[model samples]
Target chain A: MSTLISLIVSGCATGAIYALVAIGFTLLWQTSQTINFAQGEFVMLPAFFMLAGMNMGMPFWLAILVGTAISVAILGAAFKRALVDPMLRHGALPLAIATMALSIMMKEGVKEFYGAEAQPFPSLIPAIDLHFLGATISTQSLGLLAVGVAAVLALQYLLNSTSVGRQMQATAQNPNVARILGIPVERMVMYSFIINAILVSVASVLVTPLYLAKFSSGETLGLAAFIAAIVGGFNQVRGAILGGILLGITDNLAATYISTQYRSAVPLALLIAVILFRPQGLLGTAEERTV
Target chain B: MSITRKVSRLAVLTLAAGFMAAPVLAQPIHLEDVAELSGGGATVGTNFKNGADLAIAEINAKGGILGHKIEITHADSQSNPGVARALVQKALDNNPYVLLGPGYSGSVKVTESLAAKAGIANIMGGEAAELTQTGNEYVFRTSFGQQSTMPKVARYIAEEIKAKTVAVVWVNNDFGKGGRDVINAEFAKRGIKVVADLSTEAGQVDFAADVLKVKNAAPDAVFVYLNEDESARALKELKRQGVTVPLIGETTLTGQKVIDLAGGAAEGALAHVGLTTDAPIPAVQEFRKNFAAKYNYVPDHNGIKGYLAIYVIKAVTEKMGKVDPANFAKTLHGMTIRAKDEPGILMDVTYDEHGDIDRQGFLVEVKDGKQVVKTILPKMVP
Candidate 1:
């Protein structure tokens, strides 16, 4: 029972990061109808940037902020010029190919700069355990859970209450129709890309303390998030969070009860089951397309 | 064509021919080295390269191996088995007489089989027990097998530290699993209770969950059996959480990265190490001084293992007075070299039919962020 609870707490902490990355995926897919395969690389880039900043003696929080800003700016420009502009002029495949090439180049570039060694990231929170019920949880885990919840709530507010949020929704629903109604559809999509990059970057910074900063971490975490998005229902934000948490819980439970060796198999199994049974996902509405 | 143009063409052809023929005149004996030179295992491979280079330089300076200057071609396998096989094939096409190796057990297993089929002598630096059991005859190792070291490490922890209840945490790979099994068997023989046994992936960074589990179990000491990065992360996490049990385990703990990452947390950690460049042996000291002069860094066990492996090969070859592959194997199995005056090249060198080394490990403890050799065990002549 203690093991179960501990796993759940830790899983939720990791799941929160996954959910954030998945939301980035959903945002891009919703607006542009194209997935940024380089989304993971975008997430990873900020972590390394923050690490580089910290190595240069900058404060952790300052480093993270700078890293996030840099990644957002680079990702925004790249998406606009390299992906969006080309796709608008040509077609979707060119953007897809460009993103794929970007992903490879990003991975190699980071590896070359970082020298393929896992560097320890300074912890934001003190590493101490708080006993709850029978399970002991670390401050980092608690911090992760808080971050995940905060990101979700903040994103919900941004999408519903804010002007940009309404603009993004309008653009995502029907760019042609929204533009006909005088909405800046192209600007909204660009804003969505920038927002997605920031969200992923924030998630990367939060998780770096736990996993340490490494070049390939973004890809590994991004893969998990991608699965969570599909399992939850691609474009549903609430479902993405729910799916990520559920998958994290399933992974931990499988590792404890079934086999530690096959812990990674949990997300795939859940994805298949979700796809088979609830094609629309737990939180996704029936009107939403099952893509 | 004009006579002047023809004469100019002949002059250019003659210069190009001379440049091409210069390489053929020397015909350097190219020896291929495949090891993990990057990622988590880079230190191991880098050390091996240092030692191999030192030996190659020494051989060339003294007169060359078999009247041909020694040249080494290196490839990084990154501790991947598939990559190791590809590297071996790449090296074989270059027609090297000897292949130095794939540093990890998994890579060695793949490379050794390939080398055996190709009728090439492989000097492996990895200490996996199964590598010795291959019975391939052509595969030679200067390092003691994991089977030999595992029991010794377990005994050291149980008896020296007086830790009766222990937890075992290891990577879910062949090397970790193998070491864990041996340690478990050894612990059981001594009637010690294993409080918890856990496994994590090789490249995993976050070990807080695993560390929490081990802490909750409340073992006296934690036997961490993973690679350098993971082990260091585990140690740091455990320290941060105030879990202060002594860490005891494999040679991976001796890596500089582990020390750098763990900092003060690694001070009391006890680990197994074959020989450092600072060993009391005179030859080892000489090799150390020379290596430091050449590379500007102290050599680790990986470098020592690689250097000693070639030294063993050279000694055996000298004894047989021939470079025949079969003779080389026979001499290796029957050979014993004493670092007698130096006392540290290896406590003593001997080998069995399984290619198991007769060398023993030194129990080293981290003192002031450096490995201080605590006790040395004499070679167990099997």
Candidate 2:
């Protein structure tokens, strides 16, 4: 049916967005065991920065470049040095709590500086439609899907096939072993943070078209990414993608067939079911702990 | 000179000076604006304040209402009910003659009782039907209530568009919930079958499935009752799915802001609105220009609400020949102020005893990212 096709097509597109944010969360958790609680804020801040740049008379592309440049410095080195490095000694829980504080600060900071009007996109993607089986899909949604998947694929290539990828994996598996093998563990961890920042900036751009630049958008995205990370195991690249697609599809299908009020309930129930039945996520591997 | 004579003369001088020097009549008429400034309802509250400010500036420049300058103080409600209560209580202590706003319906619902108890008129921007239903005589609305507009919408669907079946998609909030209840009641009265009834959350991002449901149900028309941004998102989704059925809603659907946000998705979306800046009338066009000049952005319905409320205060107090806080509410009830009598009201309006407003409304469709008025509905009262 056309309804089924529309549900799947749109679901995959939305899933692609959630997957992008979920993978960024996975990378931080894997590389340094650092939980960046302010992931949502990181996602929201770049759009405002781009807005600021445009307001300052920069072209749209230049504004994005400016936003990326600032995000690279602030979200990467400054974030690790200020919040993660000093607090990693305390434990992951404290770092998470700290990120929670950072989240509130960034949320308020954005509101105080930029007024709460929903900033629309600069018509980056042409408004055109592609139809199939009596189901219509916009070129914008398809573009977002393509960009999201391509970003994931490119990240996968860097992680699985490059020397830096091997070193990063070594650091994630065992920092002491990586250090013994003459790989700079700290530097690999920094690379992961930098990559995390870049990924989030990309997400902010993709989401702004459909979602608009909003202050509370981060909170919703932060929650969605967390849900996707748990549903897909934190360990596998494709697992995050699978989890995002399932989440998006289930959300749409549930709203279609079930009560719309209960749309969110079904995904949360799936999360609980996943936790109870498969402790290690749908695609995540269980660790063998040695006493 | 006699000591008694000197003392009596000094006392007489003191009494005369006291009588002539201070009457407190020259003091400014105080009005407090308790609004949502920093939370989800910021856009609504901020625009309301800006509109209020413009009216105050205009009135003050022209020597004010009743020759006493109207001064307003703005308090941020933070979009929370509890915070709004505290701020209303604080404003009451200052003893304002009028309370201007808390544009959000929920905030207005909580704070209206406080002003009602204080016997001060609470002129507000909330359009929730239940707000005036609570028998609060002190509460006055600057916008259209659902009870006033929904029947007209149902009639339009039943008569003009001649739709037999309808699909209702509404936000699950106080305002949207209230609208849904009224429109459903109206639909039932008209024998229109509701094929699909969908409830969406306040900040829901995607409406793909919801739109699909509407498409699959093959309703003759769809009603989208949602908040501003959510309405745009829904419009976008509805466009993406290529749903061809006529889209109908209240002012929430075809506002200037929604048209801009939804872009071309808003074309042909019809709505009946009590106040719109896009009306071809010169008065409203002048107001739109002034508001944009002041705020650097086009004002929404909330701005119109706040602007008219201040003019209402001026009209009433001037009619009474004095600022009587106790009699302000009684005077506004069942009062008709014509547009020719007071140009600041922007349109002729009549107030019922229950504090609901009836004014000229527009049935418009979004054309080229603007509302083009298809028809003008006359006021309920002649």
lDDT of 1 by residue, A1-291 (tens): 766777788678667767777787777766666667777777778888888888899998999888888887888756676667767556556776778788878877887787555666777777677888766677777776777667768877888899888888888887889999888987888887788778877777767766656666666677788788777777777667887788777776776667666776767888888888887777766554565
lDDT of 1 by residue, B1-382 (tens): 8999999999999999999976444556667999887655666777787788888788789776555677888898866788888999899787776789778887887778888877777888777777878678878786777788888888887788888899999888777787888889999998888998888887665555677678778998888888877878788777755688788877778555577667677888888876665456667678878888997666667888878766676666556665655456666776676666223344567777767777756777888888777887777753
Scored by DockQ, the top model is 2
| Candidate 2 per-residue lDDT over residues B119-186, each given as its tens digit | 99999888889999999999999978889999999999999989999999998877788899999999
> What TM-score should be assigned to candidate 1?
0.84
Model 1, residue B130: displacement in angstroms? 1.0
Instruction: Give the residue spans of candidate 2 off by over 4 A.
Output: A173-181, A287-291, B1-28, B38-40, B63-94
lDDT at position B30, candidate 2: 95
Highest TM-score, which number?
2
Q: Which residues of candidate 1, in runs, are more than 4 Å off?
A: A53-66, A83-101, A286-291, B1-25, B37-69, B206-209, B212-220, B240-244, B263-267, B275-300, B303-331, B337-348
Clashing pairs for predicted structure model 1, backbone only: B47-B303, B281-B342, B281-B343, B281-B344, B282-B342
